[model samples]
Target: MTPTSIRPFPRWDDARAATLDEPGLLLYRSNLLGSDLRITNYGGGNTSAKIRQTDPLSGETVEVLWVKGSGGDVGSMKLDGFSTLYMDKLRDLKKLYRGLAHEDEMVGYLPHCTFNLNSRAASIDTPLHSSLPYAHVDHMHPDAVIAIAAMAHSEAITRQVFEGTVGWLPWLRPGYELGQRLAEYDAAHPGLRGIVLAGHGLFSWGDTAKSCYENTVDLIERAQGWLAQQREAKKVAVFGGPAVQALPEPERDATLARLLPVLRGLSNEGAPKLLHLNTSAEVMEFVNSADLAPLAALGTSCPDHFLRTKIRPLIVPEAVYTLAGAELRAALGGLLAAYRADYAAYYERCKRANSPALRDPNPVVILLPRIGMVTIAKDKATARIAGEFYVNAINVMREANAVDRYVGLPEQEAFDIEYWLLEEAKLQRMPKPKPLVGKVALITGGAGGIGQAIARRFLSEGACVVLADIDAEALQGVEAELAKAHGKDHVRGAVCNVTDEASVIAAFDRAALEFGGVDILVSNAGIASAAPIDETSLALWNKNQSILATGYFLVGREAFKVMKAQGSGGSIVMIASKNGMVASAQASAYCAAKAAEIQLSRSFALEGAPLGIRSNVVNPDAVIRGSKIWTGQWSAERAAANKVDEGDLEAFYRERSMLKRSVFPEDIAEATYFFAAEHLSAKSTGNILNVDAGNLAAFTR
Candidate 1:
């Protein structure tokens, strides 16, 4: 047996270490550190700590994982090399899988571990660590471990040695499966604090990094003993290899120093200092392996480990660092290209399968074949932590190799974990949009204020919006502007009479033919008759009913026919006025028609719910500048007719709402956009959104 000396790990001053007290900085450092570990040519490992606290009032115990980050190694670890996560929260997530049919509901929205809002992303092994019931968790893949795990009989051999001892998982890929499998196995065993993955590496945890590191060393010794026994029987070659070129400590130290502050900024409030550094021949040999093919396929030791160390390791060779600057630049370019392409493909397939998308795909860790594993970090502290994980993984794999091959999770499962909703929700929570993309929307009187706004917003959010109005000139104007902005293919204009079924049907048919489907119906064509009830004539009533009320019904019927036949749920937006809520003087017929439109929206909501169709209404008030109805207010004759002063007209409408301000067309547009975006209004069937500024009187009965 050979006696190998451990390298000295870097450290930070107390003041700098204090920076890691901050959860945000801790996560940043941990992520970079972990990434550096896996990516460093000679590095591939990660670090984590559990923060346990008793609630001041409830006295309930709370635990969180302050894990080292991804994208860096451990050699230059800093306080920032940690991500804080709620342990209890992660435990609760494990409970969901036990429930009945909660899969769909929990799909992308479910919590991975405890959700951490301040981290770049939760550690891939978050579940594994959280499930441990420990305060600290650290993982790594030492060169010794990698050598053994990568062997053909690794799995069978691993089983023979560690049977029923440390949990063994066949390679399942990385990310979700690694976390889930280890967690599941640990839960089943209840007492196991470590996992040996066949053809992979190892997982060790403790109350602190030191404890975990010690346990790691113990595991390494066991594997070394087993290997020594095998060698004695077979006279196997001993590891008396020639020294290889390594990353010069002076240069490495300087590079690491430059990275420390960034690590501090990511992990804690204070800077961090390194300690117990370990650079060995085993580490260098493993880093400079002749065949990196299998290493390239090996995923991170565990899922949550990805939060600390990314999916793949960074491979570095001897001359690789000689041209370090140039090589890194070239590698980054290649990685970016591969990443973007892979990500795009993954996103497209996931979208097709209704799956979530991952944040990024670049390998956080670089595994240079030689020159020692250089743990790159946003800062030095993180780089050190990453390097530590690399060492750990290497050690574990060496021991586990005597038993079995380290197996990872499957790719599909990995994607599921990468796109896990629970993790994503922590970043940003937004509602799903209405199901209407690539769907054509034909708005009657779309050139008017509300209609035009709806059209513009829909088009902006990936819908084919058609502006239809009785005023040909106005429709053309909107068409021209939208075409100029979004292109002619996206915005269309047509002249149609809502009162005539043939005209209404033809417009819908044209829209469908052009856009391949008519999924959204915006019924907003109407004439306002503000004459007093006593002065309201039968002719006026007929005109208003025919255009506003009957017109809406005709459009809705046509849209329904198109959407139902297409076998896709559709959406309809009815622009009802605030005037319809409470009565207004001299608006009897107009009020009756508007009231009917509002009810129509409610009915659509109910009927459409069963068919995946959503019906909603936007109640907007005081947005008249762009509305045809308000154009008359600015006319010379209108001023004379109303007997109001010119300057007072603008103020008059502005004072109508509680906000005492005129609503812009853009405001109404934004509201309409919500109705069309699947994220904002996915579950809003029969919903009515008020675009008016705080109209208590208008909102409620």
Candidate 2:
């Protein structure tokens, strides 16, 4: 039988690859190969190359397997992302291995075989790549390929598509055993182009990286073509009855508004989950399918997807729309309880065969019929990836049904890999855990210098940040800057005047709409005014008070309202100034309004105490950078009132401080973070954190 080589080899010239070095070329190849989201969704696939390297100390040649490292995306992988494993040592582990009883134990087994002391943790599938008799190997979970591979009689379809050019291996939990099976299959099947793992993914190899990648694209394109043909010829059968409790068009967002908050709550597992609503046509089709219940209950198409998408999704039938308020909350709680209970039962059923402690019982993917699919995770990046994998799984299931009944690995098989050392290691070996992984922060003066710095700090710590300012252009610029560092979805900009009640409400509403809820508020918007008490006019005084004090009240009020309704206690950081704590000469309006802002914050702290809401004031003195408060006429007035030159103002404030250090916007940001930290300041509220470089006159006077 002729082999189905669908596409020609990919052109990987030096110009296209961007590098000529062995490792850099491999990274370039992996990136290009994994760039296609439909073929290899970000961070899910791997590539490896075999090369000879000389040990600097011993000066002996060694075979090295440079596989994609753990926790790194192939599309953006670099030299560091490829863990260098000594191939001879990895191959020799098979002889000493007493066989792994549980999957997690392989973590210990793997590091013990690494050749370099400072090497990153190798990809857990190093052995699988090492066993293949080729210089290069590319492995990917293409949706179209999985569609065909996950169907019942997938082996028969495999023969039909490739004409017996590729070998079909039934579900084997990946490890030493799977590695040995691949080696055995390679020996038996001569002239094999690739091997299709039933209910898993594909592995293709060649003498060069280009050939290996080309072969992968070839086989996947053929599988996609075959699945398309099958889908066109097949007729779908719909169930006779209509869906129960159908929701009207107007009620969909309303339902999401009500239910998403509950779904984004903290589980007993200590995991902070955020939700993404998926409303694509493909998702809706699967959500409304007649076999939605049974098909979804059949587990994921591959165990590799187990971490992103749990064993099974939480398929919320349309009938859930019938429940409301307390009744709705109770019903949702009951659904969670049922899911947890079923997961516990599944653990018990599978534990007899595989022993690893159980992970959180909450499902990652929640199907909401016509409403949309919801993906829950601890951060935006993870949630987005999880959601993408589910959509891929949905397409696979649909395509699988086109040819035959969609099927996946047996429950026990999926359980073994999901709990295995390699799979568990992929998640457990995280980067330095950010303090605000799932938290949402809103800054009122976000388009300004100090406010944007605070937003950047929170964003770096993994918080979704909303920037609200009257300057729409600056807001857009700041948002763009933040989005470059964090993802575009994690940073949002809204034009809001804290002096306007409606604007404040709209700002907080944007936060809830962008990220399901708000967890922190930095009320930092204000203007500075300087004048003798007699010269301070009503209009001047009112403008200063409106922005400096009333603005804080308006924004803080809206933020607290949302925080209270979320029932998930949050923090409110008021950006008051030193003028509030100490009397300033010729600055009656500024001093009075700032003092009022601090008092308002103290009042808010009292109201929020019973609800676990924390309110604190960060009183910073003349944080001049990016601060327009001291520019133009205000600068002259301030200098005259203080009897100092404009240039001397910086030194005057810094030298006057107990520490003689300049107070920066970042310094103020640090103080806000301190108060925002629940673990650090859980019992402390209505407190003033002075970020004034130790201003004795205004140090919490």
Candidate 3:
């Protein structure tokens, strides 16, 4: 190894360590370990330490294990994120451990034995940590470590590295039994520095936090070094050759435009959610090669991936890439059907004693040969996580390819971990999410006040959003801001002229490609042009009708086509104006065009019903004076027509209504939210929600 080999391992700098007491040090170490994305991902790993604390009731000093609490990311963990457990009692769990069936009950019992008996929720691996005799213990699922531990010769590799100083535990479903086995293995090897859990992860320990952390870094570094040697030894006769076959046209992004919605329709899992299309050069090379295709059929890199990516990935054949239209759809459908049938057969063959509920059979990662990788999940975050696992699995497999044969855990073992109740309990403990958690929403005029408010509201309700507008600069600003808050996958902005047929189609296509498909469509793009009948020009009438009325038809028709293709019911919330239902003087062009827009929405609702689509309207009158739609000339025109100051438009509407409350954009946004919610309006399509501050004339039965 040279002096400049990029280190491959984290080096210690004691001066930078936090000046903290034992408890604070535990938190400090957690933050340090978790901060490195290579050491630990978002919430994949955990850490713990042993400290002495007074047992208040008994008035005796007792050893306590401070383990990371469940549901908290290690990088951001605090003192509260660690559960204070009595070490002796936690170790007793290993004595009571019988088999995998009691693992959930055993984990449940850990919280009751805590120092306060009301401490933070304990990490599921508390017993595993408690069983070891070390003062500090650290566990993480580092990418490089997993590559070595997930191999067929994991035991041999461990024996070779530490020469019996480190122990190897075979694939055991993580719970009480695994914890018990760890203790037994540690006891047998008295000089153990750490242990690698095969097909799971790694654990390191020492008398001090620094030592334990360094031990982990050093151990992983050595494992990485071993793999690197194997890599250097690998030789290829030929890596490049003549074109294998004609490459797919228009590139992977264009192919995804055709495939994502169809692939999303194939799933019976959650709603149409996010798709992570990885078209990186590394990924593209693997998918195109005949050699790497068979490697994907094997099980996951580690059992942990089973929770997200499932046991195996589905590789859509190369032929479908060249096909198009009905023929392509049919071919893809046949491929999905075959994959499902095979999964059913696998489930039947490996199902446990008592019939266990099968997991969602839909493959999370779908490799489109010569195109790239497509990962799907219930939400944007999970899709990214699942994608990470698949990518890591592929990397590990590639490494195993260079070192030795890549071996996956057995099918029954996969089922054991897949159906583990303790694992499911962690998911159950998470709080219930907002109503539209898995749905996708597209909002028109999204950079405008009413449109931005509607987009933000839907995002808050857990709907992944796509913001559309004609103003490219404003659209980019809103997209960057929202993406920062909700993640880049959750919110996006597209420049769209709603009146144009091709642009409208492209916007929906972007939604289908960005997210898997569109679940909710908010047609909110329109303008307010105020003029007397004699003053209104033919051009004015044409422009107002084109956007206010025709825009809805164009965007609505595209959403319908996409929704119909998805084979799932969807919702469309049209932002019509109160002027549509109630006439206003000097606003002839605006009122006439809005009236046509509202009726168009009703017509869409009536026709949409048979297709399981819901079309609803929210008729909003004058918004707050400074709202986006009324910012410039539009605000001045409305103020002049109403004979009131621009700032008084809000007050004017408030005083005109029965409720006497200002009809801000938020009020209209609230109405749009209500109409989009399936629980609130599932049985009531063709509905018009009046948001004009309780104006009776605008209210519809």
Q: What is the TM-score of candidate 3?
A: 0.92
What global local distance difference test value does model 3 have?
Answer: 0.78
Alpha-carbon RMSD, candidate 3: 3.0
How would you encode candidate 1's per-residue C-alpha lDDT over 1-701 as one tens digit per residue? 32353332223234554555434333443443344332223324566666665555467777666665444345555555545556666556655564423443433322344333545344445455555555555566644544455555665655554554556666654444457677777778876657766545677766544455556555555555556566556552222232344567566543332222222112211211111123466576565554343644565444444444554564533342344333444544454456446656755665425455545444345454433454433332344555565565554444334344444445555555566555566446434432443446788888887787778777766566778888888888888988898766567787899999888866765564344346678788876766767787999899889987899888888777655544456778888777778666667887888888889888878887887888888777766577777665224433444566765666666775688878777787777667766567878877777777767778754
Instruction: List model 2 lDDT by residue over 180-284, tens digit each.
Output: 789889999889998988988888888877777778887887887777666557655532122533356557766766666555653325745565667777777
TM-score to true structure, per model: 0.39, 0.90, 0.92
The number of residue pairs in model 2 that clash at the backbone is 3
Off by over 4 Å in 2: 1-14, 17-19, 55-62, 97-118, 235-255, 266-268, 288-291, 317-328, 425-432, 486-490, 531-537, 583-586, 655-661, 693-701
Model 1 reaches what TM-score against the true structure?
0.39
Ranking by lDDT: 2, 3, 1
- Over 4 Å off, model 1: 1-437, 633-646
- Select the stronger candidate by TM-score from 1 and 3: 3
Of 1 and 2, the candidate ahead on lDDT is 2
Candidate RMSDs in order: 20.6, 3.7, 3.0
Task: State the lDDT at 629 in candidate 2.
Answer: 71
> Candidate 2 — which pairs collide?
103-420, 103-421, 104-421
> For model 3, where is the 10-residue window of minimal lDDT?
237-246
For residues 1-701, what per-residue lDDT tens digits would candidate 3 score against the true structure? Answer: 31245355555557666567888877778888887766766676778889988898898999988888877778877788888888888766666766766676787688767896645887677777887788999888876677778778889987886667778988777667777788788988888888888877888898888888788877777777766766667753111221244345457656777777777776746545567777666566567665655677777757657667888888887778777667777888888788888888888887767545676677788887767778888787888778777776766766666676677878888876676666666667788878888788899999988988888888888999989999999999999998887777789888999999989988887887778788899999988777889999999999998998889899998888777667678899999888989898888888988888788888888888897899998988778643676765877787888899987777877898898887778888899989888877888788788887787877675
